[model samples]
Target chain A: MQQSQAPISSSSAVNRRGLRPRLTLLLGGILGIILLLDLEPYATRWLQPGGDIIFWDLHFPRVFAAAIGGIALSWSGLMMQTLFRNPLAGPFLIGITPGATFGVALVTYLGASMGLEDSGTSFALQPLAALGGAMLVLSIQLLLQKKLTQLHSLLLVGLVLGYFFGAAVDIITQTAQAQQVKQFVMWGMGGFDRVLPSQLILLGSSALIGLLILLYHRHAFNAYLLGDIHVESAGKSVKNLRLWLIIGSASMAAIVTAYCGPVSFVGLIAPHLSRKIQGTESHGPNILTSAFAGAALTLTADLLANQLIPNTVLPINAILSIIGAPVVIFMLARKD
Target chain B: MKTQRVLSAITTLSALILGLASCGEHPRDANKSDIVWIKNAYATLFRVGYSGTDSFLELYTDAQSKKIAGAFHWGTSAAIQGYEKLKDRSKIVSLSAIHTGMLAELNAHRHLVGVESRKYIAHPLLQEKSTINSLSEVAPDGPILPEKLAFCNPTLMFGTLSSIEDKQAIERQAKGKFSVLWCNNHLENHPLGRAEWIIAFGWVMGKAEKAQGQFNTVKKDYESLVVEAKKSAGTHPKVITNCVYNGMWFVPQYSSYVSQFIRDAGGEPITAENGTGSNVVNIEKAVGLFSEADIWINTDLCTTLNCLKSSDPRVQHIKAFRNGKAYHFNKQLQANGSNPYWDMGCIYPNRILSDLFHIFRDDLPTDSTYYYDICK
Candidate 1:
């Protein structure tokens, strides 16, 4: 009955040529101009001989910190997007940032409870503790991988881990000294200014190594687009590759989270923007594009954080959250 | 497109290099030896008196022609003592420093190269100088221009005990580069220590005789006050320091500094079982211990009568709150014109003793507020 009723039909489809490289370059140029404009007054002040050297001195360190931090965050975002293969997957989604925060909270609050003479030991020990916490969560995800065939199952597990970590942090904070609690609250607000020159090597190298690793495995990532079984049939050890990718991504995410406090949504939004621009989900193009875009976004946000108020700086996370949340919402709504 | 990307990358690299190079122009005459000296006597004294930990003092005395700089973060009293013993201040050419009130007393305000925090931007000199909130915020090249520091020419620098994280790093930064002295205050660090450090600072600033006389007066006055408190011991009431706020009640540990004052004033102190540590107790624990505490004292000087009246809601729950027996000690009383309360209290414990006696003993005299409004 259906064979008799069948009719041939044709619909016109638009051919969109690749112009993303030029577009990205144009956007980067615009952002650079805006940054220069925002920074001009300080430059002029610094150039003027004997015109408040103190203010000029303060400005240099802050600007350097912001630049370094922007680069690190952007690279971290690119690596995470490539590893997870989920458009919405970011550092915050995997609970790495929260896990790191839990580590710092444990050190600052719990260390105070334990009667440690040196308060700085808490800060010194936070990165290693955070790395341990992130690994723990990663191991849990790996154990549940067989049962958690669906992405939703993995996400739900991550959300539960996040909640568990948050509850533990709150309990530790309650027992801590009021002064120590105040210090933790201030740290949690997240500032690029906190990144010292000494920490730059550690943060910068880890992010670079993670991005390089992701770049080397671009072909495997492209195969991942056809789903796990197809890639497995193509003679690649998909399980081992997936584990390494997760470890690399989680390690990068965990370090940034530990050092800079939890920065949200950059990983998710940057890759999505890159994919939309490329008009294909090819790993090679997406990774490079996402890294550049992430850096640009973070740098611009930091510029706003510093310049929004004349003499004061807002938290880096606050600026990113304001810009990121709406874009994510728009992407989800458009998909729906 | 690839060529353009390369060109843009080069342009960005060149810009960054230019920016960094511009930052590198060191201030002229940036050597530590070039600045005017205020005193050099403290060097002679340290060379003679202190032999236990020569690691710190050796930095000041044995350095070469190159200017050395180190961060000092401990021993405020010891710093004061060392400085007071010093014969000259002029040898100290630059200082990475803080604590404006103490700086004013030393009269070495111009030597400040950098400040540790912006919390005291309200201070006139710091308002005019560069300040960083945290040491971790310092740039790789160091925030202060060597030329500016050279003009100030400080050979040695000092700070509070908490500011130093790595003494070795500080020494490395200053060893053959600058001399660093660690200043720790006795009252903050030690439970029962003297104000010999004031003499130390005087020695550093080349004011040894003035420091000696000031130290003597403080010691003599404290002894007399102790005797006065003892005179009216029979009539003295039971007292507690009430140092901590516990939501429902004021908590007073028997081992706190305030407890020492209460004991010296001839009052029986509750919470004498708690040790000398500044541990905070819960409201429940505080209430259980001091359910019948007669007097509640608020030691915070920044809060005015109105501010305290509004902020402290728990003040209404305790027996002391019901009786309106709360009193505040004025922080300004610790200062004599420009000198710090630390110097005042440590040197003249008698004045504090006298104040405590007046509060506890009905026959003793006190200020009008403590007399008519507070005790009654």
Candidate 2:
């Protein structure tokens, strides 16, 4: 057991390099908070135990939900990208968001439910339907994982399923009157403000628990990036790692989609931005950085949404596309 | 680089929504056949129509408006044709300002450019449009030109399909790439159902929150009046509604909002059932229902028993006409034969509800009645 001194030095250097991502995370958090508080009735009136109704109820919940949404989506994206060994793997791309959207379309189109609170022993079935839809798609993908075997086939199936669910949503919208199925289409438009103040608890706790699971297993996630043979040779259960990855990402993505509608660009763009900043494939730093970057991007888009026209909040999803689309196009079209 | 190529591929794939489903039959028309929920007021309150595009992107790219609320009144006509959300305040034309008080909103339309107001306005709106346009023209757009935004008034009850100027303007503006804002309040047969139309008006006026508040207050007052009237010591009047016009007596059905108003006001309404709109009765049934009546309402043609006698000498046997308790919603009748009751009445159902309450029980000051008038 001759320990190479070079390995020791490399490990120390890695710890020192970790400081950059931590600093970046701090800055990102600061930016997100500042943006959240920057809007009108602008002041920290939200701290006064219900001073301003606008701040206490509307803006704070929306901004906080948006931050959590960014983190969850980016973390979900990181998990998918690393697991698939592709930067493009996002929760939306693999049919999860579309599946949740499909559930929303069905719920709203049928007029079966829309968050009836006073009906004791009842909960809003809309979010649950969305969660169930995401899980259904993930379970199907997982089953296909056993049969498809190849990673490319898994990705392809995900792509096809995404389109399939999207069309299901399309058919749903087409069938229902524009007025009858208003909420059905509203789900697809994706809004941070759509998260109910009551749901903030479930959304926050569920997202945090999922993130903790990811953070706790970041080592196994890193091992997962080394491929099945490499992961097994490294004394890790590849199947277990892959299962956790799918479960963790699916739960977070499903939860966020259930709350925030179907957000885009945050997840797909976050990991790439993190990798650009950190320049490492290590899961621990990348996960933290990706979450921060996603939060920052989402908060920035939210800021633009509020400020775009006076007294109007543009759709957060549309703003994200306007920002993320160009960034992605630039990255793809770039020489390096 | 490999990253660049992979990233580009991902970007293209990310933008794809995979919209390849077989179209489904429009269910809005089927909502009428629903029979149960269709009668529920909220079901017809608002709707977001599709039929315009697979996605609402048909307007998304051109207009900077968001479809915050789809203010639709599901009527007895065909399915609503387009997806229309009036962009808040900024896009509302001034002609319709008197009803929704949109002159306050005229300040938001900076680049009102030119409004193709010729067909969109009847005489009342035309009177208001010139003043509104001059006031709305000063705002500057950095790069944008004036848009051909047309205003629609669906208040003309005698107007076809609850929307006239809009359908005509739609054809003309469709060529010029203009847009129209619509309200179908006339289709809502309930007074409050008509009044809830303010929420859509508020959306266009940039005071949707305020409209909702006003409506909530009105609803609260109306419901409270109903509760109060329940405690009053009075026998429930057997109320017959409407007069015979063109050899048929059309009365508000049991399911009609007018019937709901009468019932809510402590009156036992003599009416038909299992339908919306109005119920048509043959002469025999009409005479039979009216013979049992203790009160009569919604008579438009008769102000006096002699007038009622002249229209139909059969009025001599009517219980309400003999008792002198007959009422008509002709108080808001203007000099031009166009009544404000149809337009302004829907904006304040509490008033109408109160009027009926007073007619049935006599609590409110008689002179305070805004829509209903007692038959002398």
Q: lDDT of all the models against the reference?
A: 0.52, 0.61
Give the Å shift of residue A37 in candidate 1: 5.3
Report model 2's TM-score to 2 decimal places: 0.48
Question: Candidate 2 residues A1-336, lDDT tens each?
Answer: 111111112344456676765767676777657564555443555455333544544456667787889888888888898768888888877789889888877766554233221121111456777888998899998887767767888788888999999889777776554333544554566767545557688778767876787778776666667567756776777767777788888888999998777889988998877766665666766767887888888888877776565333467789999999989988877626
* Reference contact recovery of candidate 2: 0.00
List where candidate 2 sits over 4 angstroms from the true fold. Answer: A1-26, A29-43, A46-54, A112-123, B1-376
User: Which structure among the candidates has the greatest DockQ?
Assistant: 1
**Recovery fraction of native interface contacts for candidate 1:** 0.00
Q: Work out the TM-score per prediction.
A: 0.45, 0.48
| A1-336 per-residue lDDT for model 1 (tens digits) | 211111111121013333667766765676567557645655776545433332233333334444444545555565555446566676677677767778777776665455441223444555567767777777787787656667667777888888988898878776554446755675576654444445667777777777687677666766665567656766777666666666777777776666566666666677777666665566666666666566666667767875685334466778988999999899889869
